[model samples]
Target: MTTQQLIDQIKIKKSFLTIGLDVDLEKIPHHLLTLEDPIFEFNKAIIDATHDLAVSYKPNTAFYEAYGIKGWMSLQKTIQYINLNYPEIFTIADAKRGDIGNTSSMYAKAFFEDLNFDSLTVAPYMGKDSVEPFLRFNNKHTIMLALTSNEGAFDFQTLNVSSASGSKELYKQVVETSQTWENSENLMYVVGATKAEYFAEIRKIIPDSFLLVPGVGTQGGSLSEVCKQGMNANVGLLINSSRAIIYASNGTDFAQKARIEALKMQQEMEEIMNLRFNV
Candidate 1:
């Protein structure tokens, strides 16, 4: 989906919530295991239940990769189901992939062409050559990692670096340097909600670019603080809540419980939109 189309969905739904389909077989309802493809069945139920409450769904690739071929098949079926049933809801393949240029191109094709995800999470450690291949795709997005929510982020992202302009933090350089690459307009970013204070400075660098923010419920990132600092004129944020929503219950009513959790976030997002944008 194009950026405008994603923005339109946010407006229409009065929400910018991205529900993470990071399914764990161990945590899912026991009854679902009876199905031939338990992962897909679990995802289908969650998607069906919360599709209306969320504008996006992100399935972290690691969850699927763990189960090997069957896991991959489940992922394919899940993306297919979303595309066929709810084309308007943006799909993100949370692969966090980055490699040499040729390898990156293949990864891009896998998600953008074969699987047909609207976006993919990409690591920027390899620099422009690795990430630009993903950005080259038209109407698709490459969400580069910036200041993350993990404690380890302090190890590098926050390190001070001297540049041609002046001294700047590493994460700031990542945000600034990325804009100079080809087709950078198609770029979004992964800014963890735990670093809410950084959103203000991050926005000054790329105010219009969308941010896919995780670390919300389970990680204790405050929704109000993230919205207060990160929201732009277009409400440029996709606050993702994974475990807290999808694993709300492991009982037969898991889907319903997931919907309830998503609804709570959606309602908060609607209120923020109304107060901030008057939508």
Candidate 2:
């Protein structure tokens, strides 16, 4: 989907919520296991229930990779279902993949061409050569990791580094340097909700770029705080909530319970949008 298309969906739905489909067989309801494709069944139910309440759905690739071939098939079916049924809902493959230039291109083709995800999460530690390959695809987004919410982020991302512009956090440099790449307009970023304070600075660097924010709900990040500092004129944020919504219940009413959880976040996001953009 184009960035304008994504923005349109956000406005139409009055939401920038990205539901994470991080399905785990151990945690899903016992009844689903009896189905031939429990993973896709679970995802289908959740999407059917909460599709209207969310503007995006992200499936962390690790969840699918864990199950090997079956897991991959489930991942394929889930993305296909979303694309066929609700094309407006932006899809993200949270693969966090980056490699040498040639390898990155193949990875991009796998997710962007074969699977047809709207975006893919990419790790930028290998620098521009590793990421620019993903940017070559028209309309497909490469969401680079910036200031993450993980505790270990401080180990590298937040470390101060000497540069031509003087000392700055590594993550800030990552954000600034990425804009110089070819087709940089297609770039989005992963800025963890837990790093809310950094949003103001990050925004100053790239005010127009969309941010895929995770770390709300189960991760203890406040939605209000993140929105307060991160929101731009276009409401440039995709707040992701995973386990909290999808695992709301392990019972038969799991999908309904998931919707209730998503609705709560969507309502909160609507209120923020109304207040911030006067929508």
Candidate 3:
């Protein structure tokens, strides 16, 4: 989907929520396990239940990779179902993949062309050559990792590095340098909600760019604070909530319970949008 299309959905839904489909077999309803493909079945139920309440759905690739071939098939079926049923909803392959230039291109093709994800999460540690390949695909966004939500982010991302403008956080340099690459307009970023205080400074560097924010709800990040600090004219944020929504229950009413959780966030997001942009 184009950036304008994504922005339009955010307005139409009055939400910037991205539901993470990080399905764990252990946590899913016991009844689902009897189905041939429990992971996909679980995802289908969740997607069907909360599709309207969210503008995007992200499936962290590691969840599928863990189950091997059957898991991969489940991942394929889940993405296909979403594309066929709700093509308007933005989809993300939450595969934080980055490699040498050639390898990156193949990875890009796998997710962008084959799976047909609207976006893919990419690690920037490999630098421009590794990321620019993914950015080459038209209308497909490469969401680079920036000030992430994890505790270990301070080990590298926040470390001061000498630059022409004097010392600055490594993440600041990454954001600054990325804009100079080809097709940089297609770039979005991963800015963890836990690091909400850093949003203002990050916004100064790339005010117009979209940010895929995780770490809310189960991770204890504040929705209101992230929106207040990170939002731009386009309401440039995709606040992701995974465990808190999808794992709301492990019974037959799991999908219904998931919607209730999603609805709470959607309503909260709608209120934020109304107050912020009067949409």
Least lDDT summed over 10 consecutive residues: which range in candidate 1? 270-279
Each candidate's clash count? 0, 0, 0
lDDT of 3 by residue, 88-142 (tens): 9999999999999999999999999999999999999989999999999999999
Each candidate: RMSD to true structure? 0.7, 0.6, 0.7
> After superposing candidate 1, which stretches have Cα over 4 Å from the reference?
none
Output the TM-score of candidate 3.
Answer: 0.99
Model 1: lDDT of residue 73: 100
In model 1, the Cα lDDT at residue 39 comes to 97
Superposed by TM-score, candidate 1 places the C-alpha of residue 24 at a distance from the truth, in angstroms, of 0.9
Model 1, 51-139: lDDT tens digits are 99899999999999999999999999999999999999999999999999999999999999999999999998999999999999999
lDDT of 1: 0.95
